[model samples]
Target chain A: MHQKIGERFDGRVLDGGAPDGMQTFLVEPDLIVEVCRFLKEDPELRFDFLADVCGVDHYPEENRFEVVYHLYSIPFIMRARLKCRAGDPPKVPTVTGVWRTANWHERETYDMYGIQFDGHPDLRRIYMWEEFEGFPMRKDFPLKGYKDAYNPFGEDIDAGGRDD
Target chain B: MTDVTILTENKKPGGGSKEVLLNLGPQHPSTHGVLRLVLEMKGEIVSRIDPFIGYLHRGTEKLAEDFTYTQIFPLTDRLDYVCPPSNNLGYAMAVEKLLGIEAPIRAQYIRVMMAELARISGHLLITGALPMDLGAMTVLLYTMREREMVMDLLEMISGVRMHTSFCRVGGVREDLPEGFTERVAEFCKVFPQRIADYERLIAKNRVFLKRTKDVGVISPELAIDMGLSGPNLRASGVDWDIRRDSPYEIYDRLDFNVIVRDGGDCYGRWDCRMEEMRESTRIIEQCMRDMPEGPFQVDLPQVAFPVDKELLQRSMETQIHHFELSAYGFKVPKGEVYVAIEAPKGELGYYIISDGSEKPFRMKVRAPSFVNLQALLGGATNMNYLADVIAMLGSLDPVLAEVDK
Candidate 1:
């Protein structure tokens, strides 16, 4: 089924049968939005679900934050993924209009990695507090940010305690 | 910020004019962990709610980046915390995909047994806790008792009751202990009847029905659109299960029903999870019957560790391979992979990218709890009262630890 869909879109059968089944693709990054529309609405490939949207920060190299999407076609029992690198304040066309689920996911990706999804309905931080600085998920972001003490459990403790 | 319930409930008595701000937890009983919800209340109705998370961000993902594929097992146990075996399985399956290896038949069966037991444990928590949120503490206690048995079974196998890092990248760390099967069988036999007892306790109880039925309603269309998975999606009448659809490990060969309900409400969700526990028992019994004997871990020299010190000390080749593998780690081919499983919460997935390095270039978790957490405001707003907000929260089952991670 992936092969047929891949062929129709003039996309290569990148994975699975080709010893690379783990990462399958159907469209190039430039044509991603259109390909996603087809995948979501096409009669044969009704992948009405947007399972996840995340950004991978490739540090050490500039201009490399790839936004990946995982889509599932319920009826056909097939899955496909799309990847796009957002350079600078990096932006990808929003899929929130297609999948409401993308709303929070895109926000999270933006909040964590500072990868913006252009035209996202409410592209605000959903997990982190409003005044928190920097994208915590970025490779460069200090693990503890700027907190005096790292208390994941929210216990009250002085910062001078033994550091593990 | 005033409690949403307080404002909503006191609106008429306060002449519908008072504005209140109340904070709910980082310590509240029903808020589920250290989550702070600042609610603006007009009497007893919540005008707006601002949720502040990150009280449990342990930087597990960041920590995963520094650890080897084999070393991340203990970290995965801490993510969901409630269902560590499922986490172990998801991460192991992702690593297996990268390694291009599958577990042995016996290993797969054992994975199934442990995962299903974890599922039952998770369901018991949600079931009992949801009821407890609605003022049924006794039912919660009963559910915990059953959960304790499941945890005991896990402890017997892995030496840790809750966060057992038994699952390994290639397969499992150790084989099932003697009489482990018998203990699982005993739990399986006793569980269904206990589940029935739980059902009798609240299934048709008027208050439970009143609190849950038609409350926190999410339609099938909305459920799918919102990326909900597992029993939450199943409860909404979508017959989508990763085990059936995607078929990871030995789940393809296993026979079990995908439970669904037409009504996508709290009650429906409860019913689906209840049915799932029963279905899980069936899978466990089948696994016990079909369990086979074979090597537990993959046979790849570069991937798996030396079984004993004898091999490591005596064999020069083994030592070299171990040193090389441990220092450089086993290299996964250059590519990307997303392997998802029907975690107790929903479709738990691991999206990994490899540049042919031992360490993953990028690792993104497709956590169902995080995605499902979005629907809370949409589902709870205007449809239910302030008290129903807690019930609605109970329904969404967001683990802040996972969400903030």
Candidate 2:
């Protein structure tokens, strides 16, 4: 299936070597929507289920973020991962038009990694507050959260806490 | 934003009939846990439903990055708190895949047994609670009573009723306690009667049928496109089940039918879960009969913790191996894998990326509740009566913890 998809797309599909038995493809961010549509519409390769969409932030890498998509083809009984790199304030075309479930997944990706989906219907923070300052999932973000933004409910709430 | 604005442009020409915006929850009992729905109502019917989640978000994915693979099991437990063992199994399988090791056959059978029990417990809650939400109070009491039996089995095995982090990377934490199989057999024997009781109460009741029969209809195509899984997807007449389609553990050896209903409504969803509980019982019975006798966990000194403390003290090599494994977790090869199991609610998947470190580089959970809940926006709730919205929400069975994870 990977070879067939690769041959079909020819120039668009970059051969991403299989890692940990996962058939991965690195496609250009611009071609993702088209590629996804092909994966869904093609009779032989009907990758119908968009299992998940998530983002990974590689702090020191040039292309800071990678949007990972897990697609499962029920008919074919095959699974593949599509990955595309995006720069800071990462922008990728939304696949919501292809898979409706992408609406929430893309929003979640946007919320956690600050990756903007270009054509998403309602792209906003799905997990964090709308006015949340920085992408919490980014490696650069501190695990304890921003100190300046911290406002405890009250001193009484912290009174019974362990000092250590 | 444009959608919200369009929805609020209420006044029609001539006589003004304005649309009223109603906030359903974040606290309302019917919305489940911390899920707030902004309903655009034109009179009594809901025009648009904007579901706002994230109230239960604990950033489990982000938190997994800072913890070792072994330490992340407890975190997975909290994703779908109702079925923690299922979540644990999914995560453990992903990590085990990364590490390139398989658990023993006995351990696999035990995992199957535990997962099926978790499925039954989760379904019992949904089957009972959804009817209760629709005003069948007796169903809740009956279902809770039965669910307690399954909880007792869990508590006996893992020593925890809810978050049974019993599954480890290579296998289960410990072997099934003495007479565990007998207790399971007893539950399996009595479960059918309880199910029949539930069926008698609501399955044919005229009021129950009226409320759920044609409400929240999701066509097969829409259900698939929306990535609905487990019973919700099955209710739409989609014959895709990870247990049967993509067999994991000992599911391939187990004989049980996948319950599917074509109604694609609240009743269909409810029926599918009820039937699935019966199927789960069958699977548990088969597991008990066919369970192999061997080591419960694999003998990977580096990956699996030594079960016997006496061996560590008796042998120098064993002590050093245990010390090293405890002090520093095992490293996985630099790669990634996405392993999913047919969780009680739906497809609970763990996508793990290992950068040759003890801790995962990135962990993404494909929570079924999160995806299945999207069906509400896809078409399930649009133009439906406000009352039907609760029935639809109940049918979808969204666990806010899984959604917000």
Candidate 3:
């Protein structure tokens, strides 16, 4: 499938091989929608299902954020992982045109890692409230999280403990 | 601030339909867990739905980053709280895949049995709850009684009813207790008749059929587009079950029919689940009959603790291995893998990235409920009555924990 895709889209999509037998492809952010459309539209490889979209925050790296798309070809029963570096502000073009289900998964990636889907229809925080503090899924974000009255560290310490 | 539509079909000279805003907040019982929907309604027919989720988000993905591979097992249980074994097995298989090892043959059969049993338990809830959502009360009572049998079986096997973190990275925590298979065989013997009783109660009932037969109809294209899985996808007549299509574990060895119905409505979803439960019983019986006799987990002391408890007390090397495994869990090799199991709800997956560390660098749960619930916005529920929304939700079977996670 990667060869079939690589032959058509020439150097636009590069194979990211792993020890595990998961078929992975690293796509350029700008040409992702094109590649995804090609992958879905091709008669032999109908990767219709967008299984999931998630963000990986690689702190201090040049390309800070990586957005991973898990796609499944239902007709052929093959799976592919398309990843693109959503560089500092973490913006990647939406594939909602290819598969409508990317809507909520994109919203969730935005909510968790602050990555932006370029053409998402109704992009909003699907999980956290609008007024929440920071992207919790980022590597720099503290695991203890912000302390509130309802979620006060769970300790009977001084009330003056600073919020991270 | 919201766009409103007029019901032109019932238009009178001046006004036949007035748009109303209904805030079915988190408190609505039929919302299942904490799902808030902003429904744009013209009288009773809903035009558009804007659902507000995340009330139950616990940052499991973020939390998993700080926990070890073994510690992450309990967290997966909470995603699909109905059938936790499937989550456990999915995670276990993912870690094993990364390590490039397989759990012993006996363990694979046992894990499959557990997953199928969890599927039955999960299907049992929707079988009862979907009807209870539509105003029938007795089905839930009868189904709960049967669910207790599953719970009892789980307790007998894993010592827990709900969150049976029985599965470990290499394999299961322990082997089945004596007489467990006999009780399971008895369940397989009696469950088919109980399914018949359920069909008598509601499958043929006129009111139940009327409420669900054509309501919330999902076309095969829309279901696949919106990423519906498990029984929901099968209910729409798309024959794409991961168990059959992509065999994980010993599923290829086991023989059972994948239930598919062309109804593509709430009734079809329910009917699919009922047929699936019967298939699950068949699966369990076959797994037990051909059950292999060998070590449950692989012989990797670093990955999993030894099965022999006496070795920890008696042998010095065993003690050190146990101590290291307990103090700090095993370090997985530097790689990433995504393992998805056909969970009762759908494809429950865990994508784990290991930076050659004790804890996962990044872990993302591909929850089925979250994607399946997105189909509600695909116009199936649009033009549906406000009450049909509940029926649709029940049919979709989106557990809010999995959705919001």
Error of 2 at A97 (Å): 0.9
Order of candidate numbers by lDDT, starting with the best: 2, 3, 1
Clashing pairs in 3: none
Q: Per-residue lDDT tens digits of candidate 2, residues B1-405?
A: 544455456544632367778887888888889999999887667888899999999999999999988899999999999989999999989998988899999999999999999998999988988988888888989999999999999999999999999999999999999988789889999999999999998899888888899888999988998999999999999998999988999899999999999989999999999999999999999999999899989898888878787897788988887777778777888888999999999999899888998899999999999999998884763327888988999999999999998
What TM-score against the true fold does each predicted structure earn? 0.90, 0.94, 0.95
Candidate 2 lDDT for residue A44: 90
Report the C-alpha lDDT of model 2 over A1-164, residue by residue, as the tens digit.
67788778886788687775668889889999999999888899899999999999887688889999999998888888899998655899999999999999999998988899998989989899887767889887767665443544323323323111
Measured with C-alpha atoms, the lDDT of residue A156 in candidate 2 is 38
Among all windows of ten consecutive residues in candidate 3 chain A, which has the lowest summed lDDT?
A155-164
Q: How close to the true structure is residue B268 of candidate 3, measured as C-alpha lDDT?
A: 91
Ranking by DockQ: 3, 2, 1
A67: Cα error in model 3, Å: 0.5
**Candidate number with greatest DockQ:** 3
Which stretches of candidate 2 lie above 4 Å from their native place?
A149-164, B1-16, B381-383
- CA deviation > 4 Å runs, candidate 1: A1-19, A22-32, A142-164, B1-22, B40-42, B47-50, B325-328, B379-382
| Candidate 2 TM-score, true structure as reference | 0.94
Question: How much is the lDDT of residue A133 in candidate 1?
Answer: 57
